[model samples]
Target: MEQLQVKLGEKAQITTVMQEVFATEVGAVYQCNKRNRLVVDFANAQIVLKVDAFLRLKKAVDSIDLRDMAVNTQRCSDYELLTVCGCEKLYVLTLPEIYSFKELLGGAKFALELNSMLHECLHTQVA
Candidate 1:
């Protein structure tokens, strides 16, 4: 396994149709911050967000239904896009990048499961 320890204050270029900008540093797991946050590295950039924010992102990603899109566009030689809009910037992941993302999320499996359960509980309580 590769070393997953990402140091603080690392930066990566994030781009959109408009322009590209550097990512802002956020808290990482290696640090002692009790903010209920999950950190993932993409292209060497750290993406740190709270559990609630991550839950919202999960909702957005679910709404996209990439699997369905993949099935529909299987024959098309174009890359499918999944754009995640964070509070600071937008993260646009291509189909290949999505695979890396899946791996990163797998590292945070416990957090993902907990977030999913908490989300369901909140909805059930609300209803």
Candidate 2:
């Protein structure tokens, strides 16, 4: 049940996000052609998640074409969340926007392979 809820707080722009979010990861985070979108790279999977809204981005998480993997979705007031398969614990990704999670990152171009890799690395660990 470990989830990272990044509230926009008082901020109103995308550029400011990199400063707050980048602190969590040293070099694994990257910004692309998109403004509010970001990529979290990990050993197992690279996660492409949009930081704008919770709902619209959730849809893109579903539309992401994946092979030989599992996906789960949940509905919340703030956002709709999704979790892809991991080596052990669930790999939880939350979209905290009020709109459909699909709308925010539909135009975003990234690798789903990165998504899976981020899921495995962030959510699982070897014992």
lDDT of 1 by residue, 50-82 (tens): 556555655554455456656675555235444
Clashing pairs in 1: none
In order of appearance, the predictions have TM-scores of 0.45, 0.23
Candidate 2 lDDT over residue span 5-75, tens digit each? 23233464223333222312222444443345455443234454454432233444765443212243323
lDDT of model 1 at position 78: 38
Error of 2 at 79 (Å): 23
Best candidate, TM-score-wise?
1
